[model samples]
Target: MWLDAVDGYRHLTPESLKAAMPRCPRPVAWARALDDAIEFWGVTDIAMLLAQVGHESADLTRLVESLHYSAERLMAVWPSRFETYARASQFAGYPEKLANEVYGGRLGNIEPGDGWRFRGRGPLQLTGRYNYTAFATAIDDDAPIKTPQLVAEPIYGALSACWYFVTRVTPRASIEVATREINGGLIGLADRRRRYEQASRALEA
Candidate 1:
């Protein structure tokens, strides 16, 4: 099928994708979307892309970013913003407030409520109005800006994830470089590498 057309992705059949991401609800759709994205973006490293997507979306189970965090977690995640437990407790368990506090005043989210409005979405967790606007412009579609939730849809999610991978991270970059590009750091790096190895094995099998 579509996987056959991808230069180095011939072994990534729908069945292998399912094996790599057992929790994904629509393996076929994901395969088709990935095929289209690889062609559209000239992606060369399918395994790295799959690993990043799987890690970002929790094996394709989470399409939206979950901001819910406890005080301790908030402090840990945003040490600068939530310098202390008392400061973190203010926005603890409040996703909207947490998003606004951390994401507002930057990333083209000047307007009030823009933080939560543009919270991470899609398989790659596209965040910020800047990225949303940029992706919309790249795809020549205003829908991503007007209806950002559309990024959560399977086709759009996969496409957006691929776009990020191709544009931000080189197609053939190492998994470490790709992870840094997508995550802005080495967060969950061990898990990401594990997932990458699993996807590689599944696709190669």
Candidate 2:
């Protein structure tokens, strides 16, 4: 089953993905990221990883919408410390900014001083400060340990998430475990388990 999914994904092209996710500009990059991680980690099936990304980002349109601005732009004005920041000049009330601050900031605003507060990032949406720190240390010491900027690099972002998936979750666990972790357990494990099963079939098909 896993092999079949991998075969299907190997034939996937940016055109098809773009048709599915028009707003996202980095379909090839996304695919390469997944491919590299799967190969490097010895993860047999790339399709499962792709399916998780699709599920998390709603086929990438919603993902790009959440990103809102270019990574370069976001990095240019990223806050350095614990301070309130606006989402963007156009978007009001800092909701998106707050979300970024919590999940992608230097130190999470909501769970100050708590190393476990890292939120969503990358394809697999790696979360929690401790997890982020671990990925940074593992990948590159120079890599920003607590910033969304780091995830802007597709390979690093995918690898970080992959590391967490292989290390923290079950070796056989489906994309659902990855989703649950990404959502910080807001979505129950049971629900995610069902998602994993469905996504697994999709990928395998």
Kindly report which residue pairs in candidate 1 clash with one another: none
Winning model by TM-score: 1
lDDT of each: 0.84, 0.52
**Which digits, one per residue and each the tens of the lDDT, describe model 1 over residues 89-149?**
9998899988888999999998899899999999999999999999989888888889989
Q: Which stretches of candidate 2 lie over 4 Å from their true place?
A: 1-24, 61-92, 96-119, 174-205
Give the least accurate 10-residue stretch of model 1, judged by summed lDDT: 1-10
Per-residue lDDT tens digits for candidate 2, residues 111-164, read 553332344566566655656677777666536464545664566766765675
Q: TM-scores across all candidates?
A: 0.88, 0.53
What is the alpha-carbon lDDT of model 1 when measured against the actual structure? 0.84
